[model samples]
Target: MPTLQDVAREAGVSKMTVSNVLNGRRDRVSPATIARVMEVVTRLGYVPNASARSLSARRSNIVALAFPSRDAGGVTPMTNPHDSLFLSEVEAQVTQAGLYLMAHSVNSVESTAHSLRSWNVDGAIFLGTRADEVAALHTAYDAPMVFVDNHGTSPHISNVGIEDRLGGQLAGRRLIEAGHRRIGFVGPRFDEPGVVRERHAGFVQALTEAGLSLRPEHVVHCDAGFDHAVAAARRVLAAPQRPTAVFATADIIAAGLLKGFVRAGCPVPDQMSIIGFDDLEVARHVSPEITTLHQDIPGKARAAVEVLLTQLAHWPAARSERRVLGVSLVERESVAPPPAS
Candidate 1:
């Protein structure tokens, strides 16, 4: 394999310049120097050492994104679309800054921090992390970190996400506008932190303004997985005071709610109305379609990359800034006025 020394000798630049050029660390070197080093390295066919080059520079030119893994008997269900499309967008954005994307699984705060430090990543971006875990991450690493859910603001860390409270409020308002008063909330319970709490808070605010209470019994909690949500939906609809309308916190749960209603011989919009969050593709394909809150997935991915790259460039101005994106209400045929007695 060709070495950095060979590239430096041919390019008439120092070995350090060759190392920087090969590893995508171009901040210290000018554009002309970077171009010249690259031209010579190409001509010489020098393949530098990734490990050694990373050690010499503080950054590895790699950013890590951590998510919870599906393991064992069951894992919490996800309502948003998988990270594949989101990661693809993030990859395209960061690649322009000469950074490679690496993903890791984080079941807890301890494990996530351990993985980042072990991999020697330049910085990290976290999705679906709880508030407590976000706190632990800050204490664990001095590297640049950005969270998607605004896991609180700080000097060293930054977060980018939409106005979840507004999104939830929109869901509640839509159900009310449909002329349904007896509403039920189907969510993954409020014990776990992050998006659940934000969206629920918004839901509460909207209901309170409409002079309707989200009765404790009407707020059904279920596991995050789809199967669990399906069972929970069945149980809720079986109750004596069957809800005339349901607002599911996730698109998956909303789909489950629809299925449960259908199996129970409940005619949607005629006997029951439903709305879902995160307008995933499944939301539109389901029977009767789903009235949902449309989240900006691509926009979220792009903003996260921009924040991380700016932090990597040592530009502190953008640090600790929270960016909120807007969500739209997608109306479908699933909602209608309450059925006559």
Candidate 2:
């Protein structure tokens, strides 16, 4: 590969002048000079060094994607679709800006904080991590970051997420419309800020409006991975007074619920109506399908990247800078009115 020096020598211009032309910094150089530098660069097949360019601009040009884990290690299968969707969009947007993305998984505070600092990441986007965790990172590294599918108590952090509360409310209202008076919820019970809390809040809001409540025994809490979800679903479904309808907070848990129900010979919608969040592709492909709240993964990813890039540019953004994308209820074949006594 031809270097900037080689191009500069060929164009009879200083390396800085050649650089300004390649990186679109053309204010200092005249149009004729820029045209000359570009012609030489093309003739020499020269590509600018990204690291040097980023150093000159005092930016890393490298962002991170963090997935907070629990006891279960590795990427959660339930989260794969959501992750892939956002990553694909993130990668495309970052590439357009001449930047790159670094992906990491964090299961604890110590590891997450360590990775962020050690990696020297310019900025980060938390993928479905807790708001509190992301907030902690903000305090520790003081690095620019964007949160997706999470929230926090502080006003400083920028978060891009679907209206999880609205999603929950939609699911609850859908179940109510389907005549399910006795309802249940399945998800993590963490007090930290996150999608679970938002969706659950919405669930409670809608249930309250419908003169119903999520019975204590009916609400299931599991760790943030697969095995735990499967186990939790079994216990919840095995209860004597099982809920007529169950709203799983994550699509993965919902998938496990579907499998468990199948193994127990429990017909879906016929025995117990089901609803879930995230609108993962499997949510629609599964047998009987699933009624869910549609969250636009690509939109959230694009917004988060834009926020980080805006902050990277050191521009004045709106206060709080929070963005809550819209959500809509996806009606499918899974839900129905509870069986008459």
Model 1 lDDT tens row, 1-341: 66778778888889888777667656688878877877776677776666887887666888998776764326632323646667778878777555688877777788878888888898888887766677788888767888987545454458888878888999899888878777888887566566777888898888999999887778888755567666777777876687899888888888877887887788776898988888888788889899899988889999998778667766434456567789999988889889987
Per-candidate RMSD, Å:
3.6, 4.5
The estimated TM-scores of all candidates read 0.85, 0.82
Local lDDT at 296 for model 2: 88
User: What is the TM-score of candidate 1?
Assistant: 0.85
Candidate 2 structure, TM-score to reference = 0.82
lDDT of each: 0.78, 0.78
lDDT of 2 by residue, 1-341 (tens): 88878988888999888766655444578878877887887688786676776667645557888775533434453357788788889989886655678878766767777887776667788876666576567667767778877777677888887888989999999999989988999887757777788899999999999898888888888654556666776787777688888998877778778777766777788988989888888887788888888888898889999888767555333344788899998888789899886
Model 1: which residue pairs collide? 77-224, 77-225
